[model samples]
Target chain A: MKSSEWPLVIFSLAIQLSAGIMVIYDLFILFPMYRSRVAFPSKYHWILLIALGAALVGVIFSFLHLGNPTNAPRSLSNIGTSWLSREITGVLIYSALLMGTTILHFVMPSAGRSLKWLVDLTALTGVILIFIMSKIYMIPARPAWNSVFTPLGFYMAAIVMGASLLLLFQINHGSWASQKSLAILTISIPVIQLAILPIYMSWLGHPDFAGGKGLAILLHNHLIAFYLRLVLYLLAIAFGFWAFFTIRSDTTQNRLLFAPALLAWASILAAQIVDRLLFYTQNISPEGF
Target chain B: MSTFGFFCDTSACSGCKTCQVSCKDKNDLDAGIRFRRVYEVVGANWNKTDEGAWEHDIVAYNLSIGCNHCENPACVKACPTKAMHAELDGMILIDPNKCIGCRYCEWACPYGAPQYNKLKGIMQKCDFCRDYVLEGKPPACVSSCPMRVLEFGPISQLIEKHGDNRSVYPLPDPSITRPALFIRKHPGAKLAKKLNASIINREEVKE
Candidate 1:
């Protein structure tokens, strides 16, 4: 189980990032555009395509996690009862909706306002996808994962990642007012995450479930990784604030903001990656699974 | 419906490896893959008497487990493919052809009953020795137990005879899966929990 767990770490993070980006791209980009406050170049929607590409990468590696993937289509058979099945189904529907939206953006460039509904649909599915994905891990068998922190960690990562990536994307675009909102979002989720760290750790220290052992494993075996993720979060926060202050209404200063924005994105991407790896290490099943 | 299951007399199990060995041999399982496992749970507390002599409170027991064919089979519910499913009699079995070998069922099963067949890329576990059952014989683990401490039959009969005690020490809460296993606890089982006993052979038995 340990040996095979790494692929899932990659698979979950990639899929979640893709879902988050699709979602943020909608709220941060689409809604404003729909309100006539800003006009994004048709090329801007391709960020959704980039998100789709990450999802494709996630799907590819997810197969690596399977012992036999030829039967993957059958993975959807138990959707009536299985979260795993629903998750797989969600991925398919999300990717398809995103793909349809992206393709329409290119094929029917004049259909912009008409296609807003489609893009909105894609984004809604992404949210559902993340929820279903989180639900898959909340089963009772692994109490370490069956907690509030699991979904919290997941949603926060998506928001942080999406905001940073979108902040970087929107730095040179969007109305100055919307840019402020994006910058604030980029800076705040990580702050909230930082605040949650000690509390999450304390939750793990309890004897209920295998949390005590999970905490022990975290402090003993993965202490360095834990510290590394913390440092990354701090760096992410610093960079996020740096990027936020760098954002100015003046279009010329947008060029100056790119450095801090890109740095913030990089820092956050690294933190979330390390955070996800640490999440898997907590699989400390009850005494003996 | 048969609702086939196992009954273990924990008080009589001598921590012998025979049931574990026989199951492996009968299944032709590769190393590290086990259909039945014996868990040696041991715990201890030490105190000094006024006479300066050391006194000990030690608890030890063996728990033999296979899949309980849980009525609320989490594996079946967690399985992406319908690979792991329950039959009409409430016995859980994996349909290898449908299994994607995702190993999700492994995480869902509390008893660690499902074993990943790395070579086959599929999950495998005790089917209550279906061939032998049909032939009116006990599963290999039960027949080979030197203490005659293991039994297999319809779970209803076993629960009636064993007095319906499945939430024994060291085993997880049976309510999670409602596993069909029935047990007769060893006297020390309660003390094992109080002393925080742990399985000593984790490496050998872990998937």
Candidate 2:
């Protein structure tokens, strides 16, 4: 691919990442905050709306990667037989549900638990949309994407990436951690991601599914992507271990732990982006990879 | 009165992609946007047979595809904005203004015809060159194909003209989407009745 294609590739990766990550935020972070009675931070709502906006922007930007702009609506006509069509319909429905819930929750705060059901419904809808999106790429005809494990990996990777992004934002805002205890929780997220990485890769590289274009991207694509993933995984494990050990120690400086924690988080973000790019590039469809 | 359709003769299609090129030119398509594409379906093994006896039973078929203009188009139903519409002539179209940069249609199309424009923040697709059709001329793709493999007219007339050739096969069958485009297989390549019966039985058993 030329340098011209890089922007489009990055944009596409962002869209895939946002679709997965933003849904988790809606389900885990934002909705939970609203459901709880404890006063935490008003910033959460602003952050979520921003995330939702970003997700929409990400989706729109990815369209620039397509060959044509005018004929895009024709995609809707084939939903009866196409997974892509289902994904489109699902995304639209979820977006409507989310928008409705968001408006009602913020604009009409007195709506109370009635809006909770709407949130619940939106969350459920988002989950189904994400699943459909994953399946769109998981056609059995394409050996590279045929595995059941790929979709789960995508969902998990989204959470890992999204949480890390939100984590960074929280850290910068100084609202994420007041003491070392909160820092420990932040560190654990990447650690879980590190553990999940190997399991997902093992599933992806199973003997029955190994050696296709998709497998090859992860296994042998470029020296850079492979090395980047390795470094990211190692950083995640190392910092996770260090945070667990040093977070409790009085002598350990917060700055020392914070730096590596941020680095490990960044590395995971990079790895997931690389993985998503490889996913699209390795697809040997009728258009060729 | 204007349910448009395509009758493609696989026996005559040489995979020149004239139809594909014409569709692109007619629509002023962006780079890499193809409304029609030809596919070759290579069937049975030939390398295993002896050289003299090795008659390659390759039923190479060219698929000139655009919107199927189905009675129930998945794309139209999926569009939240109702930007995609099925015309009375059975042509599927999209109004770019109403498309909110959402790509629901892209995912909806099994044949991958709709191309999303990031610049305009909308979707676009072939309109069957309705201008030419209104002027009593065939669509650009139909006229441009050098091999004359593509025949476009009213759905009923075209079906009546060549439906009984016993070589044509429409895509995805009726159950999946009921796509209007028809595919004609090469002559002498049709499955024998006994072979077809056995194949149907095997499929039935597997199902």
Candidate 3:
């Protein structure tokens, strides 16, 4: 991949991770609290705030991907036809909602119950943001990225990162059942990614212009990186399962649960980073080669 | 609308690269940016004769290319800021003021027409030498071709005069963007593809 595209790698991953974090928070924490009055731990506002921080980081890096950051605001002008425009709009709306939600949690803690709808809206926007982001790479000329794998990889990477990160965060904060569930989610997403790998490779292995070239790139040129990505995913899956079994059915604030969860997060982060790098490499233009 | 287009007689192109140099000079492109590129398609294979002797059949040709200013340009549709748009004559161009320099159009164009200018921090491409076209002159590459291989005109006229062959070996399918390039294929292009010919000068033209 070109060095110039590195900013895009970080931008896509960070946004997906941020969206994943908000979605997980909405599903595991906010929904339960809204429905059953499971009052959040005192430091729970930090979660949404962290999500917003990640979103901000993503948005900032997105500008770094541009040739003229000053003109980025005009990038939204063509949402009528351009997926890039739609993606920019989605990022702006998602980031704004995330900021507003985080502000509400920080400024009006007592009013948290009344603002469930706002949090839900922010989470929904985040999901749509990831979808729009994936659509940016679904370019018809870029046959390597013009497939279901683009959206699937984005979603799975986001979910795994979110689940792993939440497992680390809630080690001593949340209930055992929820932490265990997060661990299971962490395990499943990567495992599902592993399952999708061969099918994606097989599709790429077909004897055609883009397919043969993409498979050759992965297997011949970037073989070490491809293997490293796979190994990281497998390592993440193993660490997730370890974290899952480590958590007991008690509220003893287990200190031992931290290592595997942290490892899982770290491994999955590396995997996703490598995955993004590899994704850009797959931009095998039909004419350039 | 009068759509600008390119007519490349690949049969006459001798890999001289004068057209490519002319475009680079006219646009003042840097080392990594090529508004017009020449691809050398080369391949050969050996065959066994009835006399039990091996004979090789070789094919080689050049494709000197620039922006086609397509009727359905992927770059135009892909540009988020509307910087890459078509004029009334369908000559696609980039407006620097509105360009975010995201380079999405560069990726969307199958012909690799849109090139990133590191100095300008924006996407740049062949404008069909719109200024020259307006002044009743041909594009730089077209005028500069020593062999008279490159030509440009209204796309329909080019197609009708050139028999509508828009792509040859290794070029993308023209149907993808309905590119305005009409080509007179080199006689060896079919043999080149059968032998799995590829662009041999990729390093020289990389963007």
Query: Using lDDT as the measure, which candidate wins?
Result: 3
lDDT of 3 by residue, B135-186 (tens): 9999999999999999888877886788888898888887888888888988
lDDT of 1 at A242: 84
Itemize residue pairs with steric clashes in candidate 1: none
User: How many pairs of residues collide in model 3?
Assistant: 0
Model 1 per-residue lDDT tens digits across residues B1-207: 237889999999998979989999999999999989998888999989999999999998888998888888899889988889888878789999999998889888888999999899999999998888889999999999999999998877897888788768878888888888889899998788778888988887784
Across residues A1-289, which tens digit of lDDT does each residue of candidate 3 receive? 6798799999999899999998898888778777777654558787887788888889899999987899888998999889999998899899988888778887787775656788889889988888888887888788889999999999888888887888888877777778988999999998888899999998888877453878888888888899999999999999988898889877475788999999999999999999999999988785563
lDDT of 1 by residue, A110-218 (tens): 6767678887888788788888888988878787888889988898888878778887777666668767777788788888988998888888888865638878888
A-chain TM-score per prediction? 0.95, 0.71, 0.96
Off by over 4 Å in 3: B49-53
Better of 1 and 3 by DockQ: 1
List RMSD in Å for every model shown.
1.8, 8.7, 1.7
Q: B155, model 3: CA deviation in Å?
A: 2.2
- Give model 2 RMSD, 1 decimal: 8.7
Q: How good is the docking of model 3, by CAPRI class?
A: medium
Candidate 2 vs candidate 3: which has greater lDDT?
Answer: 3
In candidate 1, position A285 carries an lDDT of 64
Instruction: Write model 2 residue lDDT over A63-110, tens digit each, in one string.
Output: 564444465565565566556667666756766776676666577766
